[model samples]
Every structure is written in C-alpha cells, then in structure tokens.
Target: MARNNWIAVASAQHARRGCAIPERGYMQVCHGKRAPLQRVAPGDRVAYYAPTVTMGGKDTLQKFVSIGLVKEGSPYPFDMGGGFVPFRRDVAYVPAQETPIAPLLDMFDFVEDRSRWGYKFRLGLFKVSDADMRRIAQAMQVDLALLQFESLLF
Candidate 1:
C-alpha cells in the first residue's frame, strides 16, 4: 500500500488516554463525523497533536505527542456500551514523546502565518504532506528508518 500521512488533534486528556489503550490502539477523531475517519488507511503514518501543556499529569510543552503507523483496517466504531460509540482505526505507535510546535511552525504549509499556528489544527483530523510528515517525525525523534519500513507494508 502506498503510505499516506495524517494528523490527528486531540485534547491532552483524550490523547493520553487513547495512547495508553492497547486494544484501542488508534486515535479517534471527529466524534460526530465519519468523513475524516474514512480518509485514513492502513500503512499511513499518523501524528497525534495535543494542544495542552500538560498531559497525563506531565508537562509536554504543548506539542505533537505521538507517532504511529495505522494498522490494516477501515474505520470501526467501538461501542463503549453507554451510547458512547467512537470510530477508530488500529495504530501501532512508537514510544511516546513530545516536540513543541513552535519551532516547526515555519516548516508547515498549513501554518501560513507563524503567529496563527493553532488554526491549522482545528479540524481534528486531516491529511498532511509526506514532507511535513517526515519533518514532524524527525522533530518527534522517531526513527526514520523504522518509519519508512512501516510505510512500505500492505
């Protein structure tokens, strides 16, 4: 499968919880919509961005926090059994880390104005260019060799 790049924005609390769930190995987005989730595919690289300074009681400097490879499958809705069904895909995440977005603002095309970096991530789930994805992965200290290998699989 040709690898694509995706960005998922979540609050600090949600991001921490999602990353910690082994069975729920994916990031959930657009709680009330399916269009965004439908775009993600197996083998795609995913970057989880959290806007809060503190996550899971630790200081994060408000950055992109997790990087992973989306596992094979379409979006599936997990019933939390209390009318709390969340649509998600499976992701094999790497070790969690944080990279402040401030330094990387100028590198992203979506952030036309550095002073307005936060606006670009408002959509929660969106596609990112391969170049941007690589930059983010590098910033997050992910192993590029491993990331490339993961991107090659079907």
Candidate 2:
C-alpha cells in the first residue's frame, strides 16, 4: 500500500500511553467517534503531535513525540472496560525525540503565519504534504525512507 503522510494531534498524556504500547498500536481520537480516522489506510505514516508540556505526570516538552506506520485495520472502538471507548486505528509506533515545531514552522505550507503555526492542529487528524512530512521526520531524527510514497508526476 502506498503510504500517505498524516499528522494527528493528541494531548501529552494520551500520546504517551499510545507510544508506550506499539504492538497493539492505536491512535485514539474524538472519544471513540470516527470520521477522519476512517479515512486512514494501512501503511500510512503518522506523526503524533502533543500540544501540551505535560501529561499523566510525564513531561513531553510540547512537541511532536512519536511516529508510526499504520497497521492493517480500520477504525475500531475499544471498550476500556469502563464505558470509555475511543475510536482508534492500529499502528506500529516508535517514540521519537521531542522535536519542537517552532523551528520548522517556516518549512511547512500549512503554517502561513509563523506565530500561529499551531492553528492548523485544531483539526485532530489531517493530511500533510510529502515535503512537510519529510521535514518533520528529519526534525524528529527519524528515517522517512521506511515509508513508501506514491509517485507524483507533477
């Protein structure tokens, strides 16, 4: 499958737990509601962005915290056994070095204004251009070669 690059925003706390469990990799969003997640496909490349500095007693430094490869699955609701079910997609995730988005703001087309780079993140899950994805992967010090991208003739 061709890998489509994606960015998903999560709170530091949730991002921490999601990265910790890579085997059963799941990116939960919208309290179990599915919309954008349903559009995600297997083999897609996902970069997780944490907007806050700390979560669940862990300090994330407010940065892009993890990267993952989507596994073979569709959006499914997992019952946490406490009436807490969140829609999620299976992913093979790896914790990444904290890369603050501030430095790379100018490199992304999604960020029109340097001071408001975060405005785009309001949409929890969204597609990112291959260039932006590569830049983000570079900033996180992760290898983007692992993801296979569809060729663009233009």
Candidate 3:
C-alpha cells in the first residue's frame, strides 16, 4: 500500500512530550483512541499540529510541533498509571523546528476555508495530501529525503 501523510492535533506540551519519549518512539492520538492509530501503518508519515500550549488551555501556540515516520507495529496500550491506559504507535521522529501555521494557512489545499481552517483539526487526526505534507516538512525544516529514505527501510 502507498504511504499516507497524516496530521494529528495536540497541545504543544503533549506533542513535545511524545517526541521526547525514550528512543523517540510512540505517538498517541485522539486522546489515545485506538481507532485513529489503527488507520496508520508502518512507513506512513505523521506530523503533529498544536493549537495551544496545553490541552484545553486558552494559551495559543499554533505550530507544527513534530514530524516523523511510523515504525513497525500495531498500537499497544500504555500504562500511564492512575488506571489510565492509552494506545500508542511506535514512531521514528526526526529533528524539526516548531513551525507556526499562520503563514502556511494559505498554502494548504486541505484547509478549504482559510477563515475556518481549523475545522478539520477538530477531528484530532486526519490525512493530508502529499503536497501539503511536503509543504509542512519544509515549514518545519524537516528533511524530506531523510524521511523518505527511512520510510523505504520500513
């Protein structure tokens, strides 16, 4: 199957936490819902967009915080203690800057309505066009060639 590009919405703090996890592995989406993670496969590209500094917070910080390729494996439950377990998928995150989305708002075809571009982000996780993905990678200062090469190995 052809690889797909996905955009996941999360808070900047959570997105950064996902990237900082040991081995640069694992991402949980849609509040750790397994259904969303199940749609992703090994080699697929994943980028995280944060609209706030903290979950449910008013502090705005719209940015593309993390970009990486999904690693081999199905989603597995992770014990966060407090009886809260969330499903997570392994990912090989790459180096990238936290890029703002304001400038790129007009560049994304997926954002149909620039004024209400955030509608899709409400879905938590969704697929994006390859063109949009490339544009995001560029905005985030991510090396697409490296991501492609890494994807091929999976």
Q: Model 3 TM-score?
A: 0.93
Each prediction's TM-score against the native? 0.83, 0.85, 0.93
Question: Which candidate order results from sorting by lDDT in descending order?
Answer: 3, 1, 2
Model 2 scores what on Cα lDDT?
Answer: 0.77
What are the runs in model 2 whose C-alpha is more than 4 Å off?
54-60, 149-154
Error of 3 at 76 (Å): 0.2
Model 2 per-residue lDDT tens digits across residues 1-154? 4568889888767877887866776787655678888888988888888887554346545588888888887888788887787788888875567689878887786777887777878888888987888778778876555555334321
Best by lDDT: 3
- Which prediction has the highest TM-score against the true structure? 3
Q: List where candidate 3 sits over 4 angstroms from the true fold.
A: 149-154
**What TM-score would candidate 2 get against the native?**
0.85
Per-residue lDDT for 118-137 in model 3, tens only?
99999999999888888898
Residue 136 of model 1: what lDDT?
87
- The total of clashing pairs for model 1 equals 0
Q: Write the per-residue lDDT of candidate 1 for residues 1-154, one digit (tens) a residue.
A: 5888988987667766777865557778866356787888888888888876443445545688788888888888888788988887888887746888888888786677777777867888878887888888888888777566435321
